[model samples]
Target: MAHDHAHNAPPSETAMRVKALETLLTEKGLLDPAAIDALVETYETKIGPRNGAKVVARAWTDPDYKARLLEDGSAAIAELGFSGVQGEDMIVVENTDEVHNMVVCTLCSCYPWPTLGLPPIWFKSAPYRARSVIDPRGVLAEFGVELSDDVEIRVWDSNAELRYLVLPQRPAGTDELSEDELAALVTRDSMIGTALAEAPAG
Candidate 1:
């Protein structure tokens, strides 16, 4: 958290190219800024991490649902109405006291677009793809997650056929929280296994 990887970094080539294309399209009157903003808003709120957060929250609050989710991820997730394209073959991995789960796509950035909208730039980078498996703890440290040596870290490799979603451990003192309240603590990075769910406010 303290180290903001993208804070001072220059825009990636893909990002720059997208920006240039957007500019050109706007100049040619083919792209409306307002419509672009609206589309981005829909993805960010309606179709992105919010859907994954809701799934996590439901599992936290319902043991039966959690069991079904772990047993058949695709079916369980589809029950929540989040199944499409890249997300058709989902495998939900849960994090417990003894184990932690992280996901990476070594070959390419094959991600669950239905639930997570789009993969982060870091997830698609060559360094992350290669290093996450070789040095998972080190990669996690860079993300500000320091786990005890006793805890086992499992890195799930996603591909074109199967995508993974990390079910982060529920925070303490959240037994009284409602499903929506719990969902609020489930950040995108948490579901991606780069960060933990935020602890509830005092």
Candidate 2:
């Protein structure tokens, strides 16, 4: 039996170049290597969409918490111990059958990183920023989310001062799910409004 070595190949040229650039910046004291590492660790562990997922799950399970979340996203999210620069001012929009809400940063990727983790490259791409506002339905269609003709689609453009997060509708048959299990069904794209929450696995 032969093993595949494709996965063991050296880093791509672009990756190597990026690594070299980072090394140069670190050596020149232009960048704080420790800070970069800490940021990466934060995203990978402490700060991520899981925070938002937990919030969403709680809201789905507790009506009062849901009301509080919808009334004041920043404060409600703070109640969950998630607060930071990018998330100082936040708004959470709910997705309903009659109204589907989407969020985008037209100027730049002004995302709620504390709760939503890092924004994906597509979220920051010029195409997404421009199209998400111009033709939100088309953009959602591109992502394979087809809404009924009667369902109103509202596109929220985030800015430096404030950010928006989507509270996707809870999937059915998950009434018995534990908080952690419910969180596991959430995805980064779902929180970003690019996709729906994962349906419960049978």
Candidate 3:
């Protein structure tokens, strides 16, 4: 069954309120727009999903590192120097042929900021928070991920104390790819379990 999902849903009320407050503050000369842009850039580029991508790439190439990561997500991730704030307590979930893992914050939008950066608007929406748990498979389908009936779907609920990151399965034709090359295939949504790692280009 195909679902008509709006991937670009409008910002939630909270986001609108925050934007309004920022505008008001900017108008009052209290908040520097350049500073805000710099901060967003830092998270969006430098310290964002790239950090998680590196971690995933390391795990993909090194079995020992992958074992440690699966055993102690926080410590293993800290080795890569991505830790602080919402990412203090992390749990790495592996997605295999038999099982697919999806993460959601049922109570609030608790995310691994150091790894995933800012949460997407849909992640904080009432519909996603509620529906992700109630209908995980449907949510995956909405995200354009289709799994076979033989595959098991596991939905993880993230909270203030613990956050989950999905270590997506590596693409089949990436055997000769370097760690950096492999990292390039990892995307933010894949780590968040909303999508799969990008396949290598021809």
Candidate 4:
């Protein structure tokens, strides 16, 4: 709660502990907050879900690319020159009318960073990791996705070696849109199976 936050209250015990640790690390020249900020900014703005969006849009416009992505996600993603430590190996799953796919890292916050940038806070939270596997439809419902009971849900757990990406179904009425236009319709939540891509207004 705002009233209980460290910003509003006296320095919280947890905050004091973290500040003390930061001071110690800074004295030892072991931590640089500016460097951390720069790295985080790189992921949050310059390199983000837009990279994955481009991949999804290309797949939607080109059948061959879609096949390649589904067949070999790592290779197909590397085709776009977006390869890194957390994304050396990736498994792409498709979402259809009858089946939905989701990804989670039960042990830790392993994620496809090259495509997704940084995992959102919720993705790394215990509640999400646990509830996603046990009550996937219920989790999706919390994200405003109410799937039909007839649709089956599949969950994939990602680790350091192989991460998972969900290829959300391309919305209808997008036949006239250009590849870039389609990319604009793809969002971070859609790639994570929490939501669907936006449909063309026309």
Which should have the higher TM-score, number 3 or number 4? 4
Decoy 4 TM-score against native: 0.83
Ranking of candidates on TM-score, top first: 2, 4, 3, 1
Quote the RMSD, in angstroms, for model 4: 3.6
Deviation in Å, model 2, residue 142 alpha carbon:
1.3
Model 2 Cα lDDT, one tens digit per residue, 123-161:
999999999988988999999998888988888898658
Listed per model in order, the count of residue pairs whose N, CA or C atoms clash below 3 Å is 0, 0, 0, 0
Superposed Cα deviation of residue 22, candidate 4 (Å): 5.8
lDDT of 3 by residue, 81-166 (tens): 99987899999999999999989998999989898888889889999999988898899999999999899989898865988899
Error of 4 at 122 (Å): 2.1
Candidate 4 weakest lDDT stretch, 10 residues: 2-11
**Better candidate by lDDT, 1 or 2:** 1
Off by over 4 Å in 2: 1-32
- What are the Cα lDDT values of the candidates? 0.92, 0.89, 0.92, 0.89
Candidate 4, residue 105: lDDT: 87
lDDT of 1 by residue, 89-141 (tens): 89999999999999999998888888788988999999999999999999999
Instruction: Report how far residue 21 has shifted in candidate 3, in Å.
Output: 8.5
